[model samples]
Target chain A: MKAYDLSIPLGPMHPAFKEPLRVKLKTEGEVVVGAEVDLGYVHRGIEKIMRRRPWQKAVFLAERVCGICSNSHNLTFIETLEKISDVEIPERAKYLRLLAQELNRLHSHILANLALFLAIEHETLAMMLLNVRERVLDCQELLCGNRVILSYNVVGGVRFDTTPSILKEILAVIDEIEPKLRRYAEMFEHGPLLRMRTEGIGYMSKREAELAPAVGPIARGSGVRFDWRMKHPDYVDILDFKPVWREEGDARARYMVRFDEIFECIKMIRYLCENMPKGEIRRRAEVKSGEAVHTQEAPRGDLTYFVRTDSFGRIEDITIRTPTIPNLGAFVKYMLRNSPTIADAVVIYASIDPCIACLER
Target chain B: MAFPKLVKIGLRQLIQGPVTNLFPKTPPVPVPREFRGKPRYDREKCIGCGACVKVCPSGAVELIEDPTIENPKKRKKVEFYMGLCIFCYFCMEACPVDAISYGDEWLLSSYDKFDSKLIVRDLPEREQS
Candidate 1:
């Protein structure tokens, strides 16, 4: 019997997708033959909004681009402003900013892993992961007043300073969560069901990953040893940071990379808390007419922000390139590979950890 | 090995009951000291400077002049719409008189989006010296 090709559109509103992202797939029986993606569902014209707001207000607006990595958006925007104005941030502010960014990374990785587990029908594991993640959110709330939309970073520095008690609380939280994170890593490594679902699924070669130019965990999973944290020492010099990589270039590899990264981030946060510098949290800076670009390794991947200011210190243009955009290219490629079944497509897509809000914004 | 691992987790969970809260019946989870929730407007201290109106990212704050009085120094009333507040506390930071403060009122749900409880209005006559 000959198999007929079937066309299926997965999500703009499906249980598999965390956000509204539709993928057109052509399959023969259960194996996908072709795939195409549609973005811009969550686009709020964030760049246009930034251009209209004053330089000071734009930082808050930038944070609205993505809730999970809101601090990175604000930090990158402020860094761009600092570059245009040539403002020198205090050492204490730098450490605080790094702490917030790392904490965000920890939570985001856990959330991504949770989503993958949920997609694979591992509800118990997902619940356990989420329970651990709540502690991270609580820590964030204790530090910055809000759980998700931190609005922590200001133009020249951070919005608030940390106390000894706050640092102690943070250390306590880290100490508690680190062991649970290890258990999770162990489960991912040893669990037969998880291995069956993730291992050898959605395979991408190092060459393809580089060609697609995947960033963050997706790139590192494919054995591409590229991370902004290692390259940009000026921003992340405090931690003895190293890029985590896996040669498998599959869904399991990405899962392992993120799992290991959570531990790395925990170490970085501990370091920041230990050697936190004492100084002013913020310094007022004047913005002048200029253009500047800033890049940071967001939990998903490398996020770049380009800002251009006019002669009157008003924003002329603001553009953001989120990590999910390039990873989407890799997603399309992953779907078309190995003749993935419908189930495999969902797992592979979740593995990319696509943030459609960030992509559309 | 699998039996031991399963038994270990099961015994641990048995030792430590549930991690969730019994809220509404019990008290709500306590917010952190710096938790930004509902903005508490101090009518006595507010100078009607309209700074909060200007700095609010969500346009949650508004200043209205009292048209009933024909005096040159007509006192202005400040209105805060909780529905639009992002809880960033930008209004608190911008208030010169320190009239705006955030309280730990996390449960602010209502069926009506335009509920009167959502809007905190400072009458002109209530303005303190």
Candidate 2:
């Protein structure tokens, strides 16, 4: 008989993942001993498509890279081009950008935790989290026109400007979502079932996280005090909150970090709503031949965009590096090394917040 | 905190009715007024400069030239294949003469992709506007 008695393949399409990602697990009875991740199921050829289009049209193409964190991709791409062109946006536009991106992070973190709950077989928690996410989405929709795929960021500034009434409504949304998130966090913290399933399961030590070269919450959850947002000058000038991290390096630790992050996002949004500067939202970006690299802390992690344009401001070449490459790649290789049970593996995968569309793009 | 989270949620569901709205059975939750849904066209304002034709990222907006007409001025026309429209409203934004506006129409489902009703076409050029 084989030492590893059986191999079970889980999904290019699975309930635990919203996108297609296949993971093959080699198991000895109920415990998984080894695993292999498979990609390339959802190659949309978006990068190749972006190169054919100029920056103006390509911003929309960038937004399509990930439905969940569309604004991050759009913002990063625009900033890369703008840096080369030396198009400085107004202060109000920077504040508006902060509001939009934080709301984006808020909803995305909630959704990631919702996935974790669903994978752990807690349907009730998942459904409730979906409602909380909808409120955050409404706030996003109020500021920007669309819910999921928003081309809110244009060449010089944002497309939509916020009214006083709009800021008031966003504040109201945060007020409602706060209590619900707090209550749920308390439930998850004290709930024996969640703790039993998540605590000390699928551990990613600080060393493993550094070795994986993980960024954003995945690295934060594993005790690394690294965040790309800290390096972004605009973020430092507008928002004062520090990045949230947890030391446990397990499924529970990862989700706890998300809960804290939701609160931090709420704080930043509130500050922006109160102190939002009033000014013109946009300016014309002149087309220039130059190259620049820009990185934005996306909902999943650090997303980098490198852009080189011709003398006419047409995109000569553009490259995007999404965090899931290092983050999820490490999860499959290091974190999933010795899974105790089938259910634990799913929860662990869900906890890392794998954005496959962004990864494969 | 709710000691048993499930019971607390179940009780709330018992009181607050269903979480989801009755969509398809009823109207969708009203979107904001600035919604760029159901795009409309005004032929009088269209100069046929092809700004929209160039700016449309989806390539949904087309400048359909009337080969049947010999006059170059009257030959050029605009038609919106709404099926291909991503509702990004880039065409409306790119219009130099303000030829397009938001109609606030959400549902665009039809059995035929190129149904005549689905297409927002330019009216014939007023002999000498």
Candidate 3:
């Protein structure tokens, strides 16, 4: 028997990633033996930026943290500030915030699924998913005024309110999207090639997942039934929110978890829109000296934000713990196991859906 | 069965045609009513209060004094650098006289960062109050 060790560096710039992240893999023949991750290529010192900006303007800065889950950052930041000031957001504003967050989740999950398909060379499925995701973006643009960086959440409440026609448009978009998502789910579940590539590839036990203490779909995919949305006070009465989980604990299970969650989000959005309360959309609040820790379920996982404010309403200290940080441990562990092939390694890495911008920032 | 699923999806898409627009060749799609695009400044309505400058998050709005103009009323010029603008519409909200409004034109791309087209100069003398 002969063995050859080859070190290959994948990304910092590669087709597999939308952002820059370097992963050095030590391979023997076609099997990866060791892995080392190199991040900080896309770090912009967002926490430092947040501390420098005025508390009022920092919401926009927070929104700029990650282009995909921009709303989650804003929501977490505002919720932190609101907690410090002890301001109760109006019922209507809560519903509106929930709506925006779920819409963001819809787009983010679809994009993640699109990346998974693309990683496995399913270009047609990737394009079709992108096409379907556009409807969610359109709905977001209609509701929040911007598709990507929705500066919707202000200090005390949401920036804008919706009318009946806008609500109708949103419901109509949801009506169109639900069936497409169902078909996609069917394909993911029944498609042989997809299953061949994804199934039983990146196996993580419930013990490993619990030890990593992973949050979001990654953890749930391994049978850890935990979700921040269900426990969140704002969403408690809005809908019957439940966490989706699968026991397979592979790349396919993770994929299925995200796919099913999209449907869950669709149902949540529909329920919120149907039962939306009519009231003032925003309230004036004063920020005082205090600190708060807030958490919300970002598309990737549970995102947490800690914020401190001075008496004059300036940010004293701000820290953001994005989901990618916790999931990185599980990713490294998965890569180093069983000497998986390069293709399996890529799929596993994509399965964790590493957001370098969020992690390094 | 898996092949049949792909075939069905392909046929459905083939019948429906492409979902993307022929943009640039065709005109761009219309933005929503509240979209914060290019900021339009009404020179006549500006009161030289500099409120927009105070509220701009990116320092995109600047009040440049025209040394050439001796008249105090016509001396203050508002220079809006679209390059620095994040399209947050904070300036529009801060303008007390309704001098700034969000225009629907979002295609502000340029080869040069400081393109002349990127700067909107609201000269006080151009339009009399």
Score every model by TM-score: 0.93, 0.93, 0.93
Clashes of 2: 0
Q: Report the lDDT tens digits of candidate 2 across residue range B12-71.
A: 878996658888786788887566676878876777789888888888888877777666
> Which of the two candidates, 2 or 3, achieves a greater lDDT against the reference?
3
Best-matching candidate per DockQ: 1
Q: Which regions of candidate 3 fall more than 4 Å away from where they truly are?
A: A1-4, A335-339, B1-18, B66-77, B122-129
Ranking by DockQ: 1, 3, 2
Model 2: per-residue Cα lDDT over A54-139, one tens digit each: 77788888989998888899889888888888889998999998888888888899999998898888998899899889888888
Which tens-of-lDDT digit does each residue in A76-140 have in candidate 3? 99888888999998999999999999999999999999998998899988988998899899999
lDDT of 1 by residue, B36-108 (tens): 8876787657777889888888888888876665554646758888888888888887888888776777777
| True-vs-predicted CA distance for residue B32, candidate 1, Å | 1.0
Q: What is the DockQ of candidate 1?
A: 0.74
- Poorest stretch of ten by lDDT in candidate 1 chain A: A333-342
Docking class of 2: medium
Order the numbered candidates by TM-score, best leading.
1, 2, 3
